[model samples]
Target chain A: MAVRLYAASVLALDDCLLSVMDIPGVLDALVMDHLSGTVMASGGRGEAERSAPALGETLRVTMDALAGATHRGTVRIDDLIVIADDGYHLLHPVEMPFDGPLVIYVRLDLGRANLALARHQLSSITGRLRG
Target chain B: MAAVHTLLTGLAREHATGSLNVPPAGKAYLREGRIAHLECPRTPSVERLLTAHGRAGGYSRAELEFCVAGAVLDAAYFLLPAELPAARPKFRPGECPRPDTRLEFELAWLVGECARRRAQLAQIWSSAELDDVPVTPAARLPGHRATVSALEWEILLSSDRVATPAELADRLGQPAYSVLLAVRRLAAAGLLVAPLMPRRRGRALDRAVPPALPQSDPNVLAAVKRALEELE
Candidate 1:
């Protein structure tokens, strides 16, 4: 049955999210629907409820503004990084073949997070999650 | 309804696993008291929204989870605000809807999300009346060049001035709330025909009604009597 198959998928996604949380200094991680700003999966923090829409709105506004500035009809965003005083926020967008795009949001502690290393690992995890 | 919310909260407390059937709206599927899925007639189901457009078959694990989350939220937005019907909500112990999904949400969290979504739509547009009426595009854009989202573009193209946002949502295979939000944004952008002003009730008669007079002063009573006479 489809339900049985879906349960396996859920476990896989949860494991994938666990890997996201394992990245050093990550305060939280969320998989967000780009179109509607829904939080698909969340781990490592309790703020996913509040963060999903705010971060999603930020990404949407940025995407729209950047696309306008470029005079391009459609713009593809790879990663959006925001460095705050207390933390680092990374939004990586993945385009799905059959559904609306998904954005992976991770909040990292400024003192403990390595910007370069976190980005590299996130990219690898995203590649696997996408497939 | 508040009763529905209370029922869900109670169910969560007991760690009840079953479906809560709210007729004329839809049902909520629970796993260990957490909401696993929700379906509402006003919104698209996960299967309908994702697979109905001939894009069926071979969804990645991530994609399935993503769709379920989106669909659950969408259905909750429509279902949670409804008034409880005369028929009491039935709880079928250990009953699972077909194609059960793994995405689960805390009851409190889901309710808060629905409230948040309601507040969002209210902030974007002042009225819910527009949601049910046919979406009518303006004769011209508010300006020569205005920014529009991809969904907005689709809505504009699909708006025949006949289909309401709900109907268009079903036809376009998009979540009903998303379509409603986009329509509201279009209205805010001056891209849709303005809705007619709601008719005001008779105010003169309302003002003419006398206030409670059991303990009123005689002078105030005289004024009230005179005012009542003037209406005649």
Candidate 2:
């Protein structure tokens, strides 16, 4: 049988604080500003000291670099998914009506979570939060 | 043109699938006749959204492709039916490569949330200057906590008398709908002028330009004439 995973969604009313809390082995979730790299919201351990504003700045730099590399004039990323040794990092961009680009980020345990299942769950979470 | 509102209603009824390109404006991708994803040239793409958030990283080209393929399907699943009125039957495709019922449910939920946010923003804009009124910024608004979105701030600071919401969207690289929403919101917040009646073409411009200075002030006119005669 394939490994199964659970998913949850969090809605942060404030800027970058959406909480997709407690999805089985999933550790944390956050919303960040892509243009400024500011972390709007987050849940779980080790996220206490994360500077949202700093992160937002980093994202802008990253975007600049990516655009330069691709020669695509200008580029904005929709989502970012990363698989590290310890966990999987999923970033989903939520395009707000009146704001610069915004996104939700989630980190999940690799050993205990299913990547496909998590992605599906995140997609739903995004729909609910944005819709 | 029939107008976007009318077109959307027609498309909603037809349940049409495929990408609808609005020429130089943008495109909406639909599946089985429902809007699955929308891409306005002025707004960021889905991939850009993800990378900007710091989620997926350090993947080879193959891995990126694999994830994107899955995301496209995931986005389609979430977006299509959500846009349809609740009265309609929600259809699910039979053959998904990776079958995960829970995943499907979650995707739907996220899409709905995003759509709702979009709607809220739209409501805010609709109440403002983007409507039939002349596009003018407001003098003030209430609340110390009145946080403006980036786009909103840009619109507020950059708007001159000439540019409408759609024109601003093009200049600022934002979605036209989003710009319209922001403009409306500004109006509702009393940060914009009420919509004005359509002007008579060039008349508005003519009025806007400063009239040439009077040939002379009433007193100066006679004095100037006398001085000219003496010089002659």
Candidate 3:
């Protein structure tokens, strides 16, 4: 009701963010444009926002490097993971048909987060977000 | 910007609240004079700060304020005035918009942010001709040697030529700002036939894009620096 009054159209992608937030161990999550690193939407802590610039650049550089290294015209990445002593940081690249690839990144506490479940949920969120 | 925008900005600066309606453009919603919301039927809502200025967690309060500030400022640049011939587009004493809803907010920060964003957009691609123009993908990959980002690839594949960036954004359910950036980047890359003049009419709000948030622990100080830097 408030949504109709406030925002003519309430953002639906926010649902996707909420779904990811419900996953256990997920501390922070954000989605950024793959090319310009523009923040699209997010939930959790948003600790990953600043890294968006570097993250988007990393996606570009890595895509180029991998394509060249493997000698392929196109290269597809499933996801990128960084393991830390304190927690786990995951970057999932979504092949959204609209703006190309938007990266959905999440940070998880190593102690509280189940890597398998978290990855599974992240993948699920990405799929649902695109559909 | 248009005259209706100036009138609307004045209402915001004076701490007035309501919806400043523009016949053909869009509406600006002010909360206690601080622009609380914006509605342009033809343009995508900067619903969540999706500008090219920053990158960060999109869920923090302060960050959210910054996002709000950006949305207000960016809209002012395009809608708050008739045309910005002077380098600095400020809110001079003039006509403003009369809105139906009102809230409380200081417009000082909003004013400054507008200037900053204006300078920033100029630095990005330095042209607005293509900003509102309809865009179409190139016939074939030029030289077939173009190096593009993932987002660019998506935009290229989706460009049907008839859709403007705003329309494309609506179709893809992506932020209009990101689509705006993608269009600029693609044009800069020489991958599109720009000057495809024609502003798309208003679209229904069936598929609205999502907002931006950052990923961090809830226990931190909200490292405002990271988010601001990416956007600033």
Candidate 4:
């Protein structure tokens, strides 16, 4: 029972976080369980454990605000970026099969980061995470 | 009951590998002491959720791992209550669930997380009554408009005005806890029909009224506008 079947279609997401860390000027990367606000995996210099729940709350508030401002029915937030004095915080929500969406949170160096490239990389990473 | 948590903790310390069967609730699978997976009848199992709701074709290891982790935590939340119905727990050594690349959690950390979830839900909604009742969308909005998350929207759409949160969870293949939270949030927002009617037990139900939204100050609105302009 220990030897599970080998299925090529099933790719590993273990490297996704490492890949995010490879992005230029990235300061931190975290995979967060948005529902419970738990940090599933993380890397880099930032305090991911402390920030996951706060970021989750931030995303929730942002979604609510945007929805209210738009007066639209059920708005879905694709990407959220917050600019701080020192750096940038990027959040992307990934839908999961079994539970609420998982959020991928990344912090980037303000002076060294390329915002466009970071966004593109985050999207690509999100695709893999969704898979 | 705390009984399950204590027993699992002891087994983890002993470095036991096998399944701990708590009849009626479910079973816990451990590998080399750490909890690998848990299945509860009251909640959706990872395998069932993955197979039933997973996108067509196979799943990525990340998806598998995420589902496994969520399902385990969810089951633990339901099974680790301080007091549960009376049931004898049996631990069978060297017995594990079918092989797969699964994520394991330390017994202590997992229990703590479950406790956090309980607190989180309690903080959101005071009662568990709505948890099992059919979710009913409010006939009229309390305000001109409201906001809801993707999952909340799903619940609203799937609701037949008859399916309880648990049933909706099963139908949608969502973690029961998540669905429960969404239902409570919807109720808090006045999106769901108020459950103010007294129950058969004669318990006075806390009126599910939406909290009044604070009046927006001009300065705050201006600041928000300025922030939005900057984002654009």
Candidate 5:
């Protein structure tokens, strides 16, 4: 599976601590950890080298606060799809088979991709990666 | 305690399918005598973990009652007695759609995971000094690994210098044993600091400081004095 290649790329990339390739590349691809909100890798960081760890910390705080506000005691990610000025950002967490829960993240350009197609592709990618 | 333990063990041996309530402590549901579900107030329940993981939602009182009944019957099938009894009784509870097989499997898996996690926590909690040692985040862990699970991250962040494994588990809504395992693993990996010795209870008394002992040579004179004192 091409997605498998992406997974391998993410794991393989020295700069990219984690990767989720072959996402519906509306803009580019992003690799994020759903739990920590850490951006382990990215394909397009045009004009900005955003701090991945900081972003991850922000996501964790946001999730925690949201859970607290809702009195849910836990936060479950349904799907994190956000439209930005440059492109579309999609966060898909891939569940690993082992004990350590790992997730794969992907980002893409809005003009270059279809939301439905990208989501479907990501879903398939996640399923294959998990299996 | 011996009698109760024996009874539970017997149920396990015979593969008796039923719910054994330990009054306020909790309940254990056995299917064909193998433990399928267990609830101990001291440990987080499987339902809580599933809900926390976003796999399931909190159940209403009625829904919980229904689930408890359903769980027992489903476990029975998995625990099908090696030898069928002479009279096979009919299941009375109006057949709810056979519980989603996948969900049932997941539930069982989660239950087992919780039990394992709880046992690990109990071991950590047993240590005297560590019993109340507050979990404090280590300033540094010797790892370059980029990403970890939410619970793992929480364990890293919330080890606030005092919360024990059980306390940390409660705070994070995770199985205590999981936190204990993570802590132990982190400690082994040189990620977390070892627990410090507990403070003495009595007040300090002023005394003349003793000279440092020589590293290379034994204190023959001091040893002779100690031996002479013992003999006298």
Candidate 6:
């Protein structure tokens, strides 16, 4: 994608979060700040709000680990897909201007989810959010 | 706070509407027994962070509120925890925090998040001792070069050697957790000098906290190393 400075989105993040959750196999979605684990918006059955800090901590550690392995100053991770006891927990990180490294956490149903298509669609949504 | 954790929760339970103040430290604004906003002088505001990082271009109201939500949690991580000897913050009921940014949330949930954050810090370093003790960057970039994230770069650039990670956070107008993460990461990467010599034994000890080795897992490191080589 060509880099163009996007005019900040006027869309309410809550609505954006809700729209993301409507995707097939997407059980829930929460937009959270990675730095402080603050839940900006949640659209799940509702684990996203509570797991904000833990998830943020996870992202911090993961970033450190990735940087170590890559020997890079910073690691730009688009998403992290973790398999859980019930299904899949997909964390999509969106870089926002006002705040974040905002992460969009999505719970996907393994049985019905298309990982590639979902990721592509998520990329699209995040792209629209970028500044 | 008489009961510390319970005080805030209990206040919320009773539908108390006021700001919990920890003077010279931070404040938590409660609206009708629920957490609405938080501000810490030690922890920079979202506006400050956005301005510092040059990411604040034209923030809309929703975007700013989104930032405030993150700011509230970021401050909560430092201010919410049931106090420790290292950074003991005693709160007394005080006036409401001004310029209220209304976003209602349960205090209990925030406390839970604080617990997880405490554990997360331990996961980074066995203890919070290094957090208060000043850290000095290596005279030379260990390997004559270094890779640092935006936060890490700010940390390295502003590391006075006299100011600890907490102090640096305040100085740089960044979140305490983010700065601490950078501090630990720098230590892990061997880009920072260890804070071994304790100047003061005032409660928080400077114990030997081993840095997480990048090469600990041969398999993962090897794959990444190979990928880097391939790119080269």
Output the number of the TM-score-best candidate: 4
Worst 10 residues of 2 chain B by lDDT: B96-105
Clashes of each: 0, 66, 42, 0, 22, 2
The sequence of per-residue lDDT tens digits that candidate 5 reaches over residues B1-232 is 1323334466667656656554333454545544444554444433333233332332222223222322332222212212222343232222222121111112233333334334544443433233335555556656663334355667878776755655565555454444655665455445556446432321111111212222221343333223222321
**TM-scores, chain B, all models:** 0.79, 0.39, 0.56, 0.78, 0.45, 0.69
TM-score (C-alpha) between model 4 and the true structure: 0.80
Model 1 C-alpha lDDT per residue in residues B1-232, reported as the tens digit of each score: 3656677788889999999998766788888988877887777656556544444344556655655666777888877766677777889999875665555677776787678778878888877656766688888877887778777888889887766676677666678888988988888888888435422333211222222222324454343333222321
Expressed as tens digits, the lDDT of each residue in B93-148 for candidate 2 is 33222111111113333344345545555544544325433467755665443445
The TM-score of predicted model 2 comes to: 0.35
Comparison by TM-score, 4 against 5, better one: 4
Q: Model 6, residue A122: displacement in angstroms?
A: 2.4
Model 3 lDDT per residue over B129-177, tens place: 6665557777776775777665567677777666667666655445555
Output the worst ten-in-a-row residue range by lDDT, candidate 1 chain B. Answer: B204-213
Off by over 4 Å in 2: A1-99, A105-131, B1-119, B122-129, B132-134, B139-147, B195-232
Can you tell me which runs of candidate 6 are displaced by over 4 Å? A1-13, A35-75, A79-90, A107-117, A127-131, B1-4, B54-57, B82-96, B140-148, B195-232
Tens-digit lDDT track for model 4 on B1-232?
3567887888899999999887655688988888867877666655446555534435555776677677777788876653433765778998866543445677777777777777778888777767766688888999986777778889999987666676676667788788988988888887887444423441222222212322334454443333222321
TM-score per candidate, chains pooled: 0.77, 0.35, 0.51, 0.80, 0.36, 0.68
Estimate every model's Cα lDDT from 0 to 1: 0.70, 0.46, 0.54, 0.70, 0.42, 0.62
Model 3, docking class? incorrect
- For candidate 2, the docking band is incorrect
Residue B90, candidate 3: alpha-carbon lDDT: 34
- Deviating ranges (above 4 Å) for candidate 1: A1-13, A25-28, A40-52, A96-100, A109-114, B1-3, B194-232
Question: What would the per-residue lDDT of candidate 1 be over residues A31-95, giving only the tens digit for each residue?
Answer: 66676665556776567546677888898889878877886757778899999885899999887
